[model samples]
Target chain A: MTKRVAIIASNGGLFDAYKVFNIATAAAATDQEVDIFFTFEGLNLIHKEANKQLPMPEGKEHFADGFAKANVPSISELAAIAQEMGVKFIGCQMTMDVMGLEKEDFVDGIEVGGAVTFLEFAKDADVTLTF
Target chain B: MENLKANVILDAKGLACPMPIVKTKKAMNSLEAGQVLEVQATDKGSKADMKAWAESTGHHYLGTIEEGEVLKHYLRKSSKDEASEKKHPNVINNEELEKKMEANENIVIIDVREAAEYAFNHIPNALSIPLGELKERINELNKQVETFVVCRTGNRSDLAAQKLAAHGFANVINVVPGMSGWIGKTTGINK
Candidate 1:
């Protein structure tokens, strides 16, 4: 049976973006249905402009070189792979409203919805996680 | 081992978790079913992760070979016929299998999951014949015995059961919702 995985992404740091995309893409690769909901600061992950400005959290910038050395995909590249793999991306509408952002600010192929919309999908998910 | 050739060779060396799998999935999408893919990776965990990922996706994980620091993982893409979600005509739930075990009924239980998966936990006394090796090892089993086939879920076991039936093994039953839903007695390395 194919399992459904639902993830709530609430952070948008460089490492956090990697964590979200890693889990999302891995689950999608294994034939599992996956949905990622970006809320609060996590919206930056899907924001076309904000995503390009993803900063290494505080003093952890030194690890970026190691990540590059390890051939870790950039945040935008992982996001593109996740999109191609059919991992559904949902941006929180409430967050966008609070941040004065519009749908045009996000990358293509993402659904904008509120908490209830995400809960509808997450309630019956086989695995529900927050990052 | 020297003569084994893959239709495609993916170099994932220096990549960590998810990159290897992500690239493998992309490459697999371009190949025809039954074609083999060889992935070269330096990540130590790729061996087990590749096996688990392939098994769950209905692909054939042909095991891994290590050369120096690089692990070479071979996987055969599943054919459309196999991925059509075919189920064996004869089936039993996990509970029925557990009951039979509790009653001490003489039956053969074959676990078709990868060795790594089986090593974690499996029904006691279940034979570990992975689906990829089932055809070659078919002769080792008695065709007369009542056999129950299982995997992490039921997909691989369904395919294994069909293969057994085709090989003239009668009384073969696929245990649906296999070990994933099994609440029976299990003994393995993790236990």
Candidate 2:
């Protein structure tokens, strides 16, 4: 049976972004339905331009070469794969409003929703996680 | 094992978590059901994770063979017949099962999810019999006992229940929306 996995992403650092996408893609790979709600700094992960500039957390730059050597997929690459795998990406509407952002600022296929909308989906989810 | 052949080979070596699974999922999509996929990965976790992912997705995890630092995981895409959800005739809901447990009913609950999943959280006293190992382990179960089969969802337990019924277990019941919807108490290694 397909299980629903709901994730709340509120961090935009490299590590956090990987965590969110990794879990999302893995869940999706297992034929699980996945929805990721991006709020606060996490909204940058879905931003058309901001996502490309995701940086490793302070003092963790040394891991960049190691990550590249290990052939880790870029954040954008993983996000694209997650999208292709049908992982739903939802940008928090309230955060967008508070930050003076618009739908055009996010990547295509992103659904803008508020907490209520996210909760509606999460309430029925088999697994609810935060990153 | 030497004679086994895969229709497609996916090189996921040097990749980290989610990449192996992501690439495998994409590769599996192109193959016809029942076709085999061999994934080569250097990630230490790929063996167990790949098997759990394949089984949970209705695919058959053939096995993994390690060659030095690389692990080759074999999986067979599930045929249409196995992919489709088939419920057993005898059924019970999670609520009903919880009620039975609360009442201290003398019943056997067999969890058919992977060992990792069961280790994280499972019903107390629920026997761990992963669906892949059910046939060989079926003898461990008493046919006379009233057994309830469960998994993350009803899909796997449904198949397990059918298998139990076919094996002449008369009172096997499948718990629908199994552990995913279970709100009752659970005990596992993670706890």
Residues B1-191 of candidate 2 have per-residue lDDT tens digits of 23345678999998888789988988999998656788999999898898789778878775677788998887877767544666689999999999988887667999987654565568988988878789999989999888999986688899999999999999999998888789998886425
TM-score of chain B of each: 0.59, 0.60
Score chain A of each prediction against the true chain A by TM-score and list the results.
Answer: 0.97, 0.97
RMSD of each: 7.9, 10.9
What Cα-based lDDT does every candidate model obtain? 0.86, 0.86
DockQ of 2: 0.56
- Model 2: docking quality category: medium
lDDT for A35 (candidate 2): 97
Residue range with the least summed lDDT across 10 consecutive positions in model 1 chain A? A68-77
Query: Which pairs of residues collide in candidate 2?
Result: none
Residues A11-52 of candidate 2 have per-residue lDDT tens digits of: 988889989999999999888999999999999898888888
State the displacement of the C-alpha of residue A83, model 2, in Å, after optimal TM-score superposition.
0.8
Across residues B1-191, which tens digit of lDDT does each residue of candidate 1 receive?
23345778999999888989988988999998767788999988899899899888888776677789999888878766543565699999999889898887567899987665565567888989988889999999999989999986688899999999999998999998888688878876424
